[model samples]
Target: MSGEFHLSVVIPNRNRAHSLARAVLSVRDDDAGAEIIVVDDCSDEDLSAEYSQLQAMGVRVLQQDSRRRGGAARNRGVREAGGTHVSFLDSDDVWLPGRHDRIRRFYAAPGRDRTVLVSGALLHIDGDIRRPHQPDWRPGRSLVEYCYRDGGRVQTSMLSLPAGIARAHPFDEDLRVNQDTDLAMRMDRAGIAFHIDPEPGVTKEESPRPDRLTTGAETADLSFAWYRRESGDWSPAARSGYFLQDRVWRLADSGRRPAAFAALARSLVPPVSPRETARRALSMIAGEGLYSRLRAGWRQRAPAPADPGLIAAGERWRDLDARARAFCATARDAAAGQPGTIQ
Candidate 1:
């Protein structure tokens, strides 16, 4: 909230009018003074009336004439942002309570100027399953290693960084998948500092829309291409781990067994994590469905989080969800007579 650390929240949306209001309202509730920008990526449906309602709420809605995807939309939002720092929220995601305060405290601390990015844990909701995605980053680990080797993740909604840095190091517009990983790897290679907050600050809903980019049939190939492109400078351990753990599964799931087997073979040229490689090889052999079921069973046997802090955060998320639904209902009513009422 201070002049030295005003936050700007940029949300990239495309035909998600039904969920856009919730994302906007989350930011409005979390940080009243923060700038909110929603960049529409040329949805097929006309959203002028919905945009108008959002505009009335003081949200800046930028409608693009052409579809450039979420990465480009985020880049444009950062370029247009007027705040000192920026955070991103996907149209389907919402921030948890105390997100604003956590960001403010992080930036206000001394020696934080060197920090180019900060991300916190996320409460990932996948249908009936809910899990916490904690940051796996440490001082000496590369982002790729943290992601592939350690099974870590940092979604766009969990990210916050200075506006200048975001402008200087823009997201890869060419990437339809792995954009978050691509940007984080670039930042890590640049030698800038990154901070990982342990607490969950975002509630990310994994939408099951078949039209979603991540669920596209080409997602496996695209992700593999991204790995090949970015892993050039990565250490052998990171490269091998990525192939064995991430690419192998994706390729297998996409019914690209030949490519998956080929990747598995390549991961062995300079063997790393032999156990993991063997496990993945078995998973690939077992087929995607069986592998998924086995993995789900293993997770079921694993203990659930009993942390008091996490429980409190879960309660807050439920409260936020209720409020977001109420806000959405109000928004829909306000736009009832309009051409597009965010149905």
Candidate 2:
């Protein structure tokens, strides 16, 4: 294995042990000498068997005695990572094939350095619905503006940066939600360069776990607070867009209609973009289900261009999904004293 740019894949897992193996398998590359670390956030269930399986596959597992959430777990992983570049993957999400090659290519390119943070598009899967999330950032646009005003997004699973930079700028541990956004904002403010790869690199499965942080009722409140904390350095238009579109939309989705309306009213103080705000308000009024279908339909009209890399990634994801289901079924059968052969 060449030592030009060793990659460390850090996966922060809580209680999602069933899917953790698949996540680990997605990024493991013995030939490339990629380091894989799984940081456990004080899971309630017994994970000894899972840890043993991961350890057998050469994954280094670390468990926290207390629950510190994903940010802290990720920080611990970064601190423990020994590679030149570090990439993160959630336990429920899996990186598609060619992600490591993409990272290595980015790092090997001329004019790239440790201060560069690389991200790629993600294939977000929610049940029968699948969509590709690609950021539309351009020159002279701040990360905040791209995210708020232009509908650009960057998830943790799609992020890869230098270990030194990640250690220097750790995630905000106290944040209950939107940690990815907060970290990106801080990195942008600190003059870290961002590079986005057009290829879809990860398959981010929307886990049905009810205790997931984003599904909690307090997500709106936490997101609103996060917006207020980070929007101070943003432009008025960015602020308005974030408040009216992001925060208010989240609030309405969480059934906080009164608070959402109040926030929408507040976003019109200087009237940055009345049309955008009105559109968001109308979307909220139309209900999430209808709006989601409409948005999906709109996206379907202009589908992403077909790429061989993306097509291979999707094929790999389906294979991994099948393997994960088979593994889970076998485990369950084993626990029930039945024949546990994986067919």
Candidate 3:
């Protein structure tokens, strides 16, 4: 709207057209004066109409022909952005209408600087909004230290970075799933401070998108690669840390029991939580195999029925389990009909 915008919202999208529209709309409503860029990663979906639609609404849609990953798309958007602060939105995620205004205030608060990366809580959904997982992230620590200490996640949608620092470190294009984590890790290793806005910002709809998860595995590989860049190698200790803790669950879901077991073993060293160790061991023993077990668990109804508050911010794991199952049914069906579907 003016000569210079305070924030540039970068959204990377694939085929999730409807969701993208809703996300862009939310941003526009909240941060009307901020610059918006929709980076299309060559999705087959007819987003031209959507692009035209957003452009009419004052959003800048950038087309990226080569589909590398979310990291690459985000990097391109940040590189092309013309704002002092950059925020990201995934194609399938939506932001609360007031998220931008709130975030801007958080960034402009006393003591805020370009060196601090801001992140907040993420609410997951599956046609129904799930409760926010109060991520115990502290503002004073470096991002890597946060990871080591709390094992928290920094979703791209809920994070805002200063343009100068964002330019210094771009998202890892090679990583599709965990690039955000990798970038935060890189930033942490480099002594950049991260500030967590104590509020939920992005809502993610989680379903069993196997390719997305496999893309996540590729991301894990790239994350390990990024770690190698920082720490010389994925230290057996570090590998067993948060990164492999996640991979063990994935491998378990993929039915790679032995590998998952090995990973679980690898993850059981110092700094590993006893609860997490037990959880991984039990997961391996249960023969849960990802979706099947998840669906089996999710099929059960919630003891406390969905209420307005529950829908907006419910933490009942049972409720989440049920919703995940419902969502996974469609995903499992989609994966079943399609061969070579990464699960």
Candidate 4:
């Protein structure tokens, strides 16, 4: 912590000219001596014209030989980077002001020991997260079955790792979706330590953007090498069920009600009666508002991590005053008027 601390900010982008400009500007505005690396993932047309201003500001831009996607682009950036620590920022998201300075102070904090990757809170721009929920979960030394838990995301934009750790476990370029989760799982398997601070690190512009990589369903076109991995106390089927439930919600939320029901029927997770599934499907297709409420009612079950360290790590977020309370209240309101089996 005493020596000069430098961070390499790697942004993997394609066809997000306007968002890319904003992302780059956000980093430049930090002025914390961060090295910015922009990896152009071979957009259909070159973006040199759109990004020349960034280049002029000492932002290093690298282009993939072809369309290898974000994971590959980020790997290239990490290889070319010179800082002791590296962070990934998607082209569309932005870092808030003072983020770089905070990272410096965080590393210098008392009891900050060992080489640990840091994961910060996400600011979702859309509906509340549901499914196997873990609202207050934070990373610990042991492997966490995160994919199943709701509110248990560690987004790529909110991650910063030692350059060595990042290099030792690079992103699997073949993945198009869930790459962030994949990396997190792999890191745990390799015994990498993580420090999660639930302070907003990235402001996500979440919308039903079919064009975005995260929402594009590109994984449908790719294979899952870690599809049913079992670590910690998670069973293979249990792990798969988490993603299975995810697909059901994805289909329902995307307005494919019938597909949602169909997928649910085929899932290994115990299925509700087709009549009940159809009822839910109709509600989803007919009423986005009701869909959210129904999901919110179900999400009242999100588990909070019982570990003291993990819980303490997120105290700053839980005690974020009115904003935090308001967010929690909103979630509660969504469950209003619903029959709570207290299940």
Tens-digit lDDT track for model 2 on 1-343? 2457888999998877667877877777313368999998988766665566566567789888789999999999999999899999898887776778778877887666744554555554554325544556676678888776655767798789988899999999999888988898788889887877776667787634456576545887788777776666788867766776567766776778888888898778656567777777877788766876887798699876776665666677767778766665555544564321110
What are the per-residue Cα lDDT tens digits for candidate 3 across 97-162?
Answer: 567777666666655555554555545544445554435665565565455435566767767877
lDDT of candidate 2 at residue 60, scale 0 to 100: 89
lDDT of 3 at 292: 44
C-alpha TM-score for every candidate: 0.82, 0.82, 0.75, 0.70
Score each candidate by Cα lDDT. 0.76, 0.74, 0.64, 0.62
Off by over 4 Å in 4: 109-116, 122-134, 138-144, 214-218, 221-233, 236-241, 253-256, 262-343
Clashing pairs in 3: 298-321
Candidate 2 regions exceeding 4 Å error are: 29-32, 132-135, 207-210, 261-283, 289-314, 328-343
Q: Output the TM-score of candidate 4.
A: 0.70
* Candidate 1 residue lDDT tens string, 205-290: 76344566765448987887877777777778777767876677667656678888998987885676677777788777887568
Candidate scoring better on TM-score of 3 and 4: 3
Task: Return the lDDT, model 3, position 164.
Answer: 81
Question: What RMSD does each model have against the real structure?
Answer: 3.7, 4.7, 7.9, 12.9
Among all candidates shown, the one with the greatest lDDT: 1
Worst 10 residues of 3 by lDDT: 334-343
What tens digits encode model 4's per-residue C-alpha lDDT throughout 1-343? 6666789999988876666766776677666479999988877754545555455557788878789988899999999999878888987666755678777777666555344444454443352211212246555524344444332556688788778788988998977666777787778777776666555565555645666443433343232334534333665443444435355656555555676666666553444234445655566665867766676676577744464533332342233323334433443455454422200
If both were scored by lDDT, which would come out higher, candidate 1 or candidate 2?
A: 1
**Shift in Å, residue 184, candidate 1:** 2.0
